[model samples]
Target chain A: MDTLRLASHGLSKHDQEILSKQLKMLRGRTACEWVLVDDYRSADVTLVQGQPPSDMPGIIALASTKAGKSGRYHLIEWPIRLFGLIDLLMAIELEWPARAATPLPTLSLAHRLARIRQDQWLDVAGMVAQAFQAKDEFRTTVSSFDELIERLASIDGASVRFVEGHHPLADQEAALEPYSLKAVIWSLALREEAIKSRQWHISQQQFGIATWPLFGTWETAPWMLRLAALYGRQPATLADGVELTGLRVELVAAFLHACELCELGLTVKQSTRPPRIESKLPAPESLLARLRRKLGLGYKRT
Target chain B: MISKILFIGPMGAGKTTAITAVSDSEPITTEADNLDRAQSDKATTTVALDYGEIYLDEDSSVLLYGMPGQDRFDFMWPILAEGALGAVLLLDHSHPDAVAQLDHFLEAFAALVSCGALVVGVGRVQNSQDIGVYQAHLKAKGLALPVYATDVRHKQNVLLLIETLIANAELNEILER
Candidate 1:
């Protein structure tokens, strides 16, 4: 960032001379040394005219008629502006390992688990961390799963998101409890204690889970497995699931929220199929049941 | 009448022990002196398959087949798993490439995976968090299969894996209906 070295290729000698003179005019204006180097190989920035070199070098300022940012290179255009070149060089300064300013806009995390990337860190204790002065242990009737999204939503939430590398909470990483966005969403969705969420609920539309929710990962009721199996098989509504599992409709609704929140992709059913259709085929003896009975195996919630 | 269930995993992941745990009789194994000692330090390894059985009734029986633990025997996986009720994939968590072994087995037994009839049991794991890693791996591969941390020597632990398989099978049956 100290020396703004510039090198040109395929450009007229007249343009190179003019560019050097223009850089010298802004000597005191910029803190760095704006030197127009003769060597294209060693230059910090390269200005190319017509065709750029095959070998991809450092920051490229393509002198083209095209406006705005191209794929990788910056457009210097027919007549390069000194400020544009300076701004491009300053951007290079911002990219150095020591500097810290790739600001991410803070947004409230509610039922928005899909938006959270795998790399982003979440501080479960948003505003509550300061108000209650609790470290990270918070619980509810639903899930003792850090009380992240639900608690955040209930308290009108304090925004939380740390970038993968440009971490805002890089210093306090170990101090804060970093929960996987999916795991947090799954726990919040599986509010096992209450049949229904206090604040909001997923829509009443009939849907089927695209995949099962790795139920064994959490210490939850065995009923969760039954619920997961049912919905995961085919599209069904809360009402459809109610009679099947003999669980409350609200509880099933809560499960739906868990599915949707975790970005499990619950495929909404089409009109061609009835919501609850009875199989016309005769029921056969379930081999699985016979095998279970043969092995004297009964599922106990482990 | 004979029905089939499978025990599958990488070499030395306790597929034989898991079968013997839940089997009515001692499982018959096709083993030889271990040549791949680098993979696992064991006197013998099942090169072909392991066989055991449980009587469903006085007349009928349930056959338990443990697929060979080597990748070379993957050809027999589809052949044996063709009509399998479901499968229990046992993994040795102590193995550095255990997760990779999981991906390998799950891919080899892609039929059971797609039908949601596969249960994963990771041996030598500590807690739910360790199980979470396996679950997360499955999650990444677009699978929601049941995963447990259990000692295969324990019959109850082995049964639990089978029970989940049965449950998944029954659930698939219900959905088909």
Candidate 2:
């Protein structure tokens, strides 16, 4: 087995040696090589960084992955480290076939869309489709209303609309129009089976939003006009589809919201509940702790 | 605020361990080792919910509840999970039939998932081979939930597990706005 190390701004000679020594046991004592992908281009290095890089800000380094044959790369940052280990074990089990590529491009594209767009109420379906077309890691799925609003806010020129009096979100929700044409497009792109059956069609078209826009705007659009745009709309079904990479459904929504905020000049107000603490019963000693006591064995509480 | 929770899994999947891990006091468990009708393998299984509590911040308390892992006790799930804010689905990766165990619990309880519940999967598979196999199996179930290889032997590990689930749950709630 081979190992690699990646650093923030490329790896130093010292960092390379450190990773090699740390992973010396990766391949038993058999023949192994340590390659340093200084530019962070190698797919074989485990890219670990404390916090995120200053340039990348909120974006964390994608997990390490092996080099693959097919262009069908599937790099991922599994929420659990065990999964990453699983990837390695699976590779070994499969005799080290083409590596699973990380979906870094898609993630980068998502972040770029999020940080660079400005739109007022962008179309969810269109944005998701575009994301998939670009081979990003965000798949179109049933999303929370708040996610849509936040993503829109992240993009430029995009804004969410709330039902004039019925909106429940604070500043973000109060500003959105109840009926949106874009929501219909979104519903069509996702949940194809449901759309084909015409199950979520009405709700899809009649969807209302309340959230901040990607950009701010004071102009109020007429409800009747917005409703007209929503009228005569049929359920959205999956016509053509593209697969996303290894990101969570919620993450996709957040990335999309970020993109919308950047692309559209939409702004919104939101109402949120203060974090409430839930009360409960008392705690119990762990079975392990109990067993140690019963056995009269000293166990230090670390 | 009582943060309601539910535990769902097959018999002997460690739901009690999870509840007991974070509970502030001794967990109230209904162990059914004496019931003649109980499955021989599940003789010492938890029959009803395991109730306990833990505090995070001054204003919030996380109420812990565990559900019976047996189908015979399925009738009590609704009552046990009446106001549950989320759920923890235990996966006995060490079991000979891991997939079968998951199907027994999750396949039939789609309602729990639909109610905006945050279900975290705890897989106890130790062997690397078993871990990979179980990972693929979990993916096949479309659980889409985060899974971790956990051991309840350490309090710190247990705390980290709970925190991870809580963070994810909070992230969903925040995004749901």
Candidate 3:
């Protein structure tokens, strides 16, 4: 069992004594044992009766009468009770992502890249081999970018994640057959199915083109241009884009999610609920539809 | 409405070929003997403008224009770019001053660039991926235009560049309003 030591600040002389006694009583019963300590620097959690020190690092429990306005610190109503303390500790353990006690032998592609850049871990062969075998969004090996794009076009994009830092599926030899982050994500979005995001909740957030998608060597269509045009006006939800463009909701969702993932810093997150999806677009004098017919954009002419 | 798109870059950046690749018919070009071997070894280069047209209908067409590679004929740029959709700036990666040329052509076409109507296409040099290098340069200059590694001779890449320019043109319409 892990031992979690806690330190207290602004505790009454009698309250500290009671906490010490409570710690002794609750030591062996819980999954994680708790002990009261003097120094916060040496403790897992620190309970402060008043305002917790600003920008404090470790887990902090604010024992205050008022509810927490900033959801940074754990809240414990004063005077703190045994149940509050127990609940706070339990919640902290639950909230933090559970990393196994032992690290995995085969590190992820992201981890390997990080290790190579940070620690200069010289495992290029291993990195290449691991990435080639990657069944997820981390799949890196391709003869040409066009080939990879063709593959992405045929596969299911719903499971692919537009994770930051892992945007470019780069190896040492990626320079020869390189792909832009935009191209990779855009091709994945071609699957035109409901997709996952490493960052945003696709249904819950509004998306806009904060910046243009940096598609290199990847052919774009008129509807995509229209999509960019719509986003250029204002930030909109995926459903809004779908209705206006008459594009697949899944396609728009994945595309918007990819744009956001590229760190274009779109205007999103004002609302948590999904938008009202309506079937409406600009008046029949649509230049995009006309352009499509004249230029053979929607259909492959060549 | 006629939407004219220009392809501008330094000598031998494959502007003529790019225009030819996507043009519906054989493009018109005024090619003269290359007196500047130090710049480009190509036997002939565009002196005035290389013209190609995709006939949209009997009334209108999408005009593909290629600006003269040499800066001496730069007087024709603003004249050609007037009421133009945008321009694609192709770079010959082998040129020693390719990066400098990027800055130069970008500065030359600042109006088109500022309105998000420019896409930079850099041809690859051997096994090198210089897309990031060009992109980093664009980023440093606070330009958000797309930089692509392409062989403009390939119809796919040329078509994509045209698509990108169209996308930019559509985007500019919204942003301007």
Candidate with maximal DockQ? 1
Model 1 bad stretches (over 4 Å): A1-204, A208-217, A220-222, A233-235, A254-273, A276-285, A296-302
Q: What root-mean-square deviation over C-alphas does model 3 reach?
A: 12.3
| Fnat, one value per model | 0.33, 0.00, 0.29
Q: For this target, which candidate reaches the highest TM-score against the unseen true structure?
A: 3
State every prediction's TM-score relative to the real structure.
0.56, 0.37, 0.60
What's the best-to-worst order under DockQ? 1, 3, 2
lDDT tens digits by residue: candidate 3, A1-302: 56677898778888888778656644543456677889887877888877666755578888776333247687775755443454566556555444234222332222222112111211233223122212112234565667665655554322233333432334544433334434455555444333432234546666655455555433466666556545644566776676556766666765664454433334453456655445333223344334545555542211
* Model 2: per-residue Cα lDDT over B1-177, one tens digit each: 446566677777777887787677799998867354433365587766678776544555667777876667788776666656556777776667667765665655666555324343445654333443544554455443334455555554455444433433433343344
Ordered list by lDDT, greatest first: 1, 3, 2
- Candidate 2 lDDT over A202-280, as tens digits, reads 1112221122111101111121111111110111111100011122333223322331322221111122333122211
User: Tens digit of lDDT per residue, candidate 1, span A145-225?
Assistant: 454445655532234533344445356434544343455556655654323332222334466775566454443454566
Report the C-alpha lDDT of model 1 over B1-177, residue by residue, as the tens digit: 677889888888898888888788888999899999888998899987899998767767879998888767777888998878888888899999999888888888888888888888888976445766886677677666677777888887887677677666666665677
Instruction: Give the Å error, residue A268, model 2.
Output: 28
- How much of the true contact map at the interface does candidate 3 reproduce, as a fraction? 0.29
